[model samples]
Target: MHLYTPHMLLAFLLLCLAGAAFPCSAAPADDGSVLYSTDFTNAEGWITNSKDRFYPEIETGRYHYLLEGGTGGYSAYTLPQKVNGQFTLEFDVTPEKTDDGSSFRFGIGTDKKDSQRGPLLMVELANKKDGRLFYLKTVSKENSLNLVGSSPSTGSSGATVRFEDNTTYHVKLTYYAADSRASIVVQQQGSPDVIFTASAPVSGKIEDLTNLYLTAIGDGTSGPQAEGYIDNIKLTLSPTHAAGDEKDAKNNKGADETPAPVITSAPATPTDEPTPVFTPGPTRTPFPLPPTPTPTQTPKSGLGFLVLLPALAGGAILAMRKYP
Candidate 1:
C-alpha cells in the first residue's frame, strides 16, 4: 500500500502540477492606483447624504457620522470614483468622542453633483474648542493652498495632531498630478506614530476627483457635535511609468536633475518603452508577483511550492481510489 515513488512520483508530479503551476490569491496588487477599497461590510458604492444637523448611516461595520447638535450641520459620502491624475486617499476615521465638536471632511474634490465645483482637494480635520485645524486644502475659485499647519498647533508645513478621544485615525492623502501637488499623513490606526504631516500647492486642475467626498461638520459653537466612524475606504491611482519607484519618480523630476541628461544620450522614444522593463502591470503591488523575493523574478520557494501541490493531489487520488 505504498506507492508514489519515482522520486516520490516526481515530487508528486511537481505537487500535482502545483495548483496548475502555483496559484493562490487574496487579491490586491494592481497598483495602477485608481483603486477604491472598502470595509463597510455592505452598502455598496455608497452615495449617502444629510444636512443641517447631520446623520448618515450604514452602520453594521461602519460609516455612521452623526452631528446632531449643530449650526451648519452636514454629512456626506458621495464617492463613486473619478480621480484623474495621481491619487492615494486612504481612510479609517473613528472619533465619537475626545471632546470633539466636529469636522472630518475626507478628500478627493468637488462632486456633490457638481453645480460647479471648483477643483477641490481636502483633508480638513477641524475640531475647535480653542484650536485644531489639521490642514491640507486645494480649492479653486481662483486660489487656495493651505498645507502643514492651518492653525492651533502650527500650520504651514508640519506639526498637527490632537485627534484623540475614541481614536482610530489612519488618514493618508497623496495627490501629485504633476505638481498640482498634495500630501497629508496621519497615523494611529495601528500606531506607527507619525501623527501628521502636510504639503500644499493646488490652485488649478482639480476639475474633480469626483468622490469619497465624505464630510461631517458641526457648529454647535464648536464643542460637542461632530462624531465619527468611517472605516477602511481607500482609493489609489498613482502608478504610471514602468515602476521601480515610478522609475525613480521619473529620474528625479528635474530640480536640476542633471548628469547632463545622462551625458547627452539623446535617443529616447519615450525612454525606450520603459528601458526593457520586466516588472510589468503599472509596477510593483498591483499585488503578487509570485511572492516577490525577486531573485531573478520569481519562484524562490512559493510557499513550499504551494504547500506541496495539494498534498500531492490528495495523495494521487487516494492511492488510485479504492478507499474501501
Candidate 2:
C-alpha cells in the first residue's frame, strides 16, 4: 500500500479547492471621469424657457428634452462639474416631429449665469431647409459662427445627416490637445458598424484648462417643429497621444526582445549505392510420414502405483522414442 505525506495531502486538497473557484481576468482601469450625465425622462436641472420653449424630462434613466415649434429652440444645462484638457463629450440625441422644424445645440465654457444666456464654447445642430446637419459655434457675444457653410473654413459645410423620427443617435466629440484638433463622430442605433468622423481645428484656449459649461440646445427651424431626446451624456479626458501610436511603440519594444524566425537549409538525400545481390544455395527435401496416433493401455491403482507410474511411463516412452 502507498500513502501520501501530510504536506502532500494538504497541497492536493488545496489544489482541488482552487480549481472550483471562478476564473478571473484583470479589469481595465477607468481612466476617465464624467463631467455631466442625465437620462431625461423627467425635468431636472434643465431650463426650457426660451423664444422656442424646450422642456426636458427624465424617465427610465434617460432624459428627453422636448422642443416647441417655430424658431429659436434651445435647452441649456448648467453642469455642477467642469473639466479641461483633452476631453470627450458624448450623448444620444433624438428629434421630435412638428410643423416648424427643429434644431439642437450643446455648449461648453465658463458660464453658468442662465440657460438662455452665457459666455461659452457652443456646438449647434441646426436642421436646414435641405435637412442637413449644420455645425455652428458661438464664442462670447459672437453667435452663429458657422464653421461649415458660407463662412470660408469657419464652420463645418453642413454635412447631410440622415435623420429618423423617434430614433436615437449617438454623438461623440473628442479633443486632441497636442494637435489642437477636435473631432465629432456620430452613429445611429441598431445599424451596421458605420461611423462618420468630422474634424475641426481647435483654438482659443481649450486645452489644459478648467471650469466650463456643458449644455444642449434645441430649435424649430421654419418647416417642422422638432423635439429630440437625449440620454447617457458622458465626458471623459483622455491622453493626447493617439491609441495607434502607443500600440506601435509597444510592438517595437517587443520586437527588440524576441528573435525573428530563421529559414534553414533542407536535409540532404542519401547518396550510398545499394549492396550487390548474391544468389542462394540449393534447396532440401524431407522423408515420408508416420501412422495416426493410438490410445495407450490403463494401469490399476495401488500403494506403490504413483511412484511406479512415472517409471513405467518413462520406460514405455523410451522403448518407442526416436532422437532428432
Candidate 3:
C-alpha cells in the first residue's frame, strides 16, 4: 500500500523545520567591565514603589510597567558604585504604548531613589514625533525636550527604526564623561539595523551619578495607556575615558556654546551586518566586544535536534520508498 507522496513528505519536513526554528536573544556590545547587570531573573536589586496599579513589577525575567491617568512609578536599582568616567549603557527595552503622556525616561543620576530630582543624564523616549516616528533624544538639566523640540533635527532613528508598538529594541547609550556627551544607538531585536541614533553633548556637569532609574510615567489624564518592558540590563564603566579625550573634551566644550547639537533624527533600514558598536565620541568608530559566554544563546543541539532527526528519517524513507 502506498504511503505519503513526495510532496506531502516535503511539506511535513518543512513544517518540522519551522517548528525547530526560534529567535535568539539580542546581543548588545558585550565586552566591558560590567559594573551592574540583570536580566530581571528576580526582584532582588530593583524597587518599585508607586501606587498599587500604576507601578512597575518584575515578572518572567522582564521589568514590566503600566501607566495611565498621567501617573506612573519607577524601577529603581542601587548601583555598586557611582556612575562616572567614560561609560556605556546597554539594554533591551520595549515601549508598548507611548501614544499618550509626555515620555519615559531612564539613566543614571545621584538620586538613590528619585532620579528626576537630581543631576540626571538620561535618554528620553519622547512623546514628540518627527512625522510618524517619536523622538529619541537625550535629556538632562541642560538638554530639555523644549530645547530639543525646535524642529529637532532627527533625534531620528539610529538608521531605520519603525519604533513599532510591542516590539523590543536593543539600545546602547554611551557617555563620555570627559565632554559630557551622550550618543545612542537603537535597533529592533534579532536585527542589525540602527533605527535611531543621536550624539549630543550632555551640556553641563552631571555630578554624583550614583543610581540607576527607569521612571516610566504616563499622561496625567486617562487616554491610551502607556506601557513598557526592559530586559538584559547592562552598565559598563570604561575605567577611563577614550585615549586623549580629556583634551578633546576641552576643545569640544565650545560645541555646547554653539547652537546646541540638535538631536538629529532618521530611521535606518535593517541590514545583515553585525550590530553597530558606539564609542563615546563624534567619530562613531567601532569597538569590538569581548567574547560572550556560550550560556546565553539557546543551543541548537538540544531537543529540537532530536525532534528534527525523525523528520529527516521520515523524509528519507518516503523519498526512497516505492510508490507503486
Candidate 4:
C-alpha cells in the first residue's frame, strides 16, 4: 500500500496557490483618460477655411457642417500638442441629408507650417457603387495626391450602418501607432447596442502630430450635397501617456508662431431641415457578446491536506519504531 508523503502534500498546495496568483486569461481594459472634449458651445478651438463653402457654424447648440449643392467643404483644428502611442477619437454625428454622391470625411495627421497638405489618415462615410459604405484611407508619406483616396480592400467582416436622415450615431476611431493599425465602431444612439465594427491596417507615418480635418464633399452632378450635425467631440489617450511627455514637448516647439490658423466664417444661421426617408443599405444587427460565467467558489481541499500532514507524520514515525 502507498503511504502519503510530506513532499507530495507540499506539491499540491503550491499548485493551488499558483493558480490563484496568476489567472490564465483576462480581458483588456476599455477605459481611457480624456484628453480633449467639447460640446461645441463655441467654435473656440476649430479653424475653418477662408472659403465660405467650407465654413461651419455653431447653431442650435451644436457644431453644424452643411454643404448646400456644393462640391466640398473643409474644416480643421490642430491639437494643442502632438500625441503618440494609443489615442481614441469619438464623436456624435446626426446626418441631416446624405445621398449617393455625398461624402463625409474626417482626417488626422501632421499639418505643415503653411501648406494644407500633410500625411493624413481619413475615415470616409459615403455611398459607393457597392452601396452605402464606410471606408478608410491614408495619404502616403510621398505627399502625392494620386494616392490620397486609395482605400484598402480588406477589413473586419460586419454589416455597415446606413444612416437615415436625422438619425444620430456615436462613432469611435482608435489607432495604435505601435502596429500602424486602426479600428472603427459606429453605434446608432438609443437603438442598437453596436451598429458595426471594422479594423484595418493604416498606412503613412501616422505621426503623433497636431492636425484634424472635417470634410463634406459632393460629386457636383449627383444628388443633394452632404449635411451633418456634430457634437460631443472627445479625444482620449492611454494612461501611460496621459500626462505630457518628452516627445510631446519636443513637438510643441515653434507651434506658437504657426499655431492653428484663424477661422473666420459667416454668422450663425439655421438651415431648413431635410425630409426623412428610408435609406436602403445593409440590415445591421448588433453583434452578440459572450455570456459572462458566474464565478464559483474554489474548493478548500488544500487546507484539509495541510491539516492531515501533521497527524500523518506522527503516525508514520510511531509505525516505523514499532516495526523496527
* Candidate numbers, best TM-score first, in rank order: 3, 4, 2, 1
Among these predictions, the greatest TM-score belongs to: 3
Better of 2 and 4 by TM-score: 4
What C-alpha lDDT do the candidate models reach, one value each? Answer: 0.52, 0.44, 0.56, 0.54
Per-residue accuracy of model 1 over 181-284 as CA lDDT, tens digit each: 56666667765555554556665666545665554332344445556677877776655523354334434432422111110111222222212212112221
Compose the digit string of candidate 4's lDDT tens values, residues 8-53: 5545555665664454654444345677788877767687653454
Could you tell me every candidate's TM-score relative to the true structure? Answer: 0.26, 0.49, 0.58, 0.55
Lowest summed lDDT window (length 10), candidate 1 = 257-266
* Model 2 per-residue lDDT tens digits across residues 1-324: 336554455465455444433333444443555566655555466654462344544235554444433434445556565555556677777666523235455656553422234233444454544333434242322221213321112232222344456667777666544554454556676653323334454434453223333233333234544455567776665533455433433344322122111111211232354322212112211111111124344343445644554655464445434221
Best by lDDT: 3
- Residue by residue across 240-282, what tens digits does model 3's lDDT show? 4554654444354323223334543332342455433322344
Give candidate 2's TM-score. 0.49
- Model 2: CA > 4 A from native: 1-30, 41-44, 47-52, 56-61, 66-74, 98-102, 112-123, 134-146, 149-160, 207-224, 239-324
Decoy 3 TM-score against native: 0.58
Better of 1 and 2 by lDDT: 1
lDDT of 4: 0.54
For all candidates, the clash counts are 14, 39, 25, 0
RMSD of each: 19.2, 32.3, 17.0, 14.0
Mark the 10 consecutive residues where model 2 has the least summed lDDT.
284-293
